[model samples]
Target chain A: MRILKFLLVKEFKQIFRNKAILVVIMVMPVIQLIILPLATNFEVKNIALAVVDNDHSDYSRALISKITSSGYFRLSGYCNSYNEALVLVEQDKSDLILQIPPHFESVLLRENSERLFIAVNAINGVKAGLGSGYINEIIQQYNQQLRSKLQVPGKFNLGPTIQIQSSNWYNPNLNYQLFMVPGIMALLVTIVGGFLSALNIVKEKEAGTIEQINVSPVKKYHFVLGKLIPFWILGNVVFTLGLLVAFCIYGIVPLGSLITLYTFVMVYLLAILGFGLLISTFCDTQQQAMLIMFFFIMIFILMGGLFTSIDSMPDWAKMAAKFNPVSYFIAVMRMVIIKGSGLYDIRGHLLTVLGFAIVLNAGAIVNYRKTF
Target chain B: MHSVIVSHLTKIYGKEKKVAVDDVSFSVDKGEIFGLIGADGAGKTTIFRVLTTLLLPDGGSASVGGLDVVKDFEQIRQTIGYMPGKFSLYQDLTVEENLSFFATLFGTTVAENYELIKDIYVQIAPFKNRRAGKLSGGMKQKLALCCALIHKPNVLFLDEPTTGVDPVSRKEFWEMLKRLKEQDITILLSTTYMDEANLCDRIALIQEGKILSIDTPANIIKSYPDVLFAVKATNMHQLLQQLLRYPERLSSYAFGEFAHFSFKGTPDTDGLVTYLEQHGLKEVMVKTADITIEDSFIKLLG
Candidate 1:
């Protein structure tokens, strides 16, 4: 116990004295929490649209006004011919083209239907898909208005209409930042905890100081715990700072009990820190440790259900996500912060992370050799 | 009572399985200053590493303080103090912090063993607050020594502790070891400097993972088998060339301002001078030279 105390003091002093580590610990949470969430928004807006209106009729003009007023698109060009509108798309000036054939209003009234052509630039698939979907929805609504005006509403009722009274339970406003902040907090904590502890022992190896430690009477578990406790505290500090950034910038607060959230965080940190120490034992230099940790961290973040939903992934990817500790933390963070989940709700996640902490730490202690 | 003992210890490295320490054996009695003298890559460090419990011997067996190196390594680690060839203390930590850390790591306080490290610690006490990396090479050596000695272990292993230190510091370091020896701490140290070999009570001259000879400094010199001579002339390089061609020459090497030469049979100083002058070398001089440890080392290598 005395040995562990001294080791912790030494590790903390060295960590705080290193300007590079201090900078990383302080700057990473702020940048990841504040800037990344705002930049990673998937909501597509401001699509440039070109209109080829050969009809020049009242109905066609009304449709154009409706599309522009919907605020999903900006009218970038107005042309007399379809070829002219095609030129706008080719020049990258427009993302979509809406063409109304001649006699559009007359045909719709006389024959009950008219053809409208929409040409989308499919280079950015998501933008094109969403842009086309929005336009289609608007045209359907306009067609409904025309049908009701042309017929008597009481005589010709359009069957029974079923409306979806959809209400978002957790986040009513559908704010993207609220959904992203907790996951980003999980990512930030993983980065700070994983990288710092991974580099800790390897730095001693490069400096030749580990040999001194190895020859001492200090037990392996004592040394491992010494390395773990300091970085664990630092990980908590980074996490708290992330929470502050989340609240101050995005006006997000944990809906659940703070004690329950902290319980999960404490266990998750142990699992990640244990993983870092395991990598440290296999590496002889800081560069090796950094590269190995980077490789694992990249995989962890991508498959972690942070930016992508796990349910939508392929079978192999879902399997990978199932094994990822980061995914569990992201899940728990969202559940506790947004869903107001209690300990009973996150019991399974908490137990899995606790298992990770035990297995990884045991592996690290076993692999760490006092002799070569 | 032997504090450290090895019999035919071997260490093979890497997939290539190159022999690093080959069939080497030696022993150090209690409280004696034993040195392993060799140049770099002579396996001095490897031997030190094996005995310190940082490495396991590939073959044979070794023990420290009557504990087996491979089986009883845990107890061995507790009783040994090791300072690697490279300065191995935490460079970002202050000197005092490093000392205190090692002290506490051994489950003791600095105040508990203050008497053991007092002589050396006093020298570095003024710079206790300065980070170790900023210290000079000599100061770094001293600080490393202090950290190693903080626990006052039964055996101390120092690997090239004075390799890059200045002359004055190296001299002072040896003096500190002498004082440490009086405290009844068994010391096992390695050095590449031949002069430092004399300071050890006994040394094993090693090369290429093998021991060439093992004896006290005076005894090793006394056992030299040939009368050696130092030869000099106006054209020293040409003189060396001519001396090598001498049929009776046993060994020849350039040492400082003169070339040390030995004969196959007996001292033929006059004949050698005449032979050198006949070869057109000018102002030739020859004198019988004292056989230092270096000369004995060269003789033994032959």
Candidate 2:
């Protein structure tokens, strides 16, 4: 017990003395949390639209004005023919094109129906899909207005109309930042904990100080705990900083109990730091440890449901996500922060992370040898 | 009583299993300073590593403080203070922190064993707040010695402690070891410097993982088998060549300003000088030389 105290003091002193580490711990979280959410937005906006109007009738102009006023698109060009609009799309000036055929207004007025053409540049799949969907919704609204004017006092009531109204729960605004802030906080905490502990022991190995420790009377558990506790505390600090950034900049506050969130974060930090120490035990140099950690962390982040939904992934990737500790933390963070979950809600996630902590730390202690 | 014991100890390295320490055996008595003298790659560090519980010996058995190196390694680790061939302290840590860290690691404090390391610590005490990496080579050696002695273990294993140190620091380090011996702590240190061998109570000459000889310095010199001569001339390089061609030449090597030469038969100082002059060598000089540990080491290498 006494040995562990001295070891912790030495570790903390070394960590603070290293200016590079201090920067990584204090500055990296703030920068990454603020910038990553604003940059990785999923909502597509400011789509450029080109209109080819063969019909210059009042109804045709009304439809064009409606599409532009929806705030999802900008009217980039007004061409007289489909060929002219195609040129605009080819020049990358427009993302979508709308073509109204000749006599479109007369046909709609006489036969009560007319067909419009929409050509989308399919190179950027997300932009193309969302842009076309927005245009279709606006045209349908125009048709409803025309039908009401032409209906002879809603004769026969169109055989009982059924209108379905759906509202988004948890996040009524569908604000992307609200969804991203919690996951980003989880990711930042993971990075700080794993990288710092991974490099800690290997630095000693490179400096040849481990030989002195190996020959001394310090027990294996004492040394491993000495390395673990300091970084664990630092991980909590980074997580707290992430929360402050979320509340101040993004105007987001957790709806759930703070106790539940911290409880999960505490266990999650243990599991990740244990994994880092395990890697440190297997490596002889800092470069090797960094490379191995990079490889694993990349996989974890991509599959952690941070940027991409785990539900949309392939079957094999989804299987891998089930075992990822980062995924569980992200899920718990979103649950507690956005949904106001209690301790009982995250019980399963808490237990799995606890298992990870026990297994990885045990492996690290066993692999750390006092003698060759 | 023996403080350290080894018999037929062997250590092989890597997939090729190259032999590093082969069938080597030695012992050190309590309160004695034992030195392993050899050049680089002579397995001096390997032996130190095995006895300090940092490596496992493949073939033979060894013990420290009457504890088996393999079975009672934990106990051996508790009783041994090892300073590896490399300077292994935390370079980013200050000298004082390093000293206290190692002391607490061994379940003791620097104040508890102040008497043991005071002589060495006081020399580096002024630099207590300075980072170890910023210290000079000599000061670094002193700080490493202090950390190793902070716990006052039963035996101390120092591997090439004075390899890159200055002359004055090396001399002072040997004096510190002498004082340590008076405290009844057994010392086993290795060095590449042949002159340092004379200061130890007993010295073993090692090469290529083999022991050439083990004895007191005076006794090893007294056991020289031939009368050696120091030969010098204006053209020293040519003088060596001419001496090697002499019919009675046993062995010849350049030593400092002269060539140390021995004969196959009896003393032939006059004949050697005449032979050198006949070979067009100028200002030839010859005299019988006293055999030092280096000369004896060279003779044993034969």
TM-score winner among the candidates?
Answer: 1
Give model 2's DockQ, 2 decimals. 0.79
Candidate number of the best DockQ: 1
For residues A224-310, could you state the per-residue lDDT of candidate 2 as single tens digits?
889889999999999999999999999899999888999999999999998998899889899999999999999999999999999
Please give, for residues B1-302, the per-residue lDDT of candidate 1 as tens digits. Answer: 99999999999988999898999999999999999998789898888888887888899899999999989989998888999999989999999989888998888889998998898889889999999999999999999998888888999999999999999999999999999999999999999898999999999999889999999999999999899999999988999899999999999999889999999997899999999999999999999998889999988788
Least accurate 10 contiguous residues by lDDT in model 1 chain A: A363-372
Which residue runs of candidate 1 sit more than 4 Å off their true CA positions?
Answer: A149-155, A158-162, A370-372, B274-280
The residue pairs found clashing in candidate 1 are none
Instruction: Please give, for residues A321-365, the per-residue lDDT of candidate 1 as tens digits.
Output: 878999999999999999999999999999999999999988887
Kindly report the fnat of each predicted structure, to 2 decimals.
Answer: 0.98, 0.98
The TM-score obtained by model 1 is 0.95
- Alpha carbon deviation, residue A192, candidate 2 (Å): 2.1
Every candidate's lDDT: 0.91, 0.91
Q: How good is the docking of model 1, by CAPRI class?
A: high
Q: TM-score for all predictions?
A: 0.95, 0.92
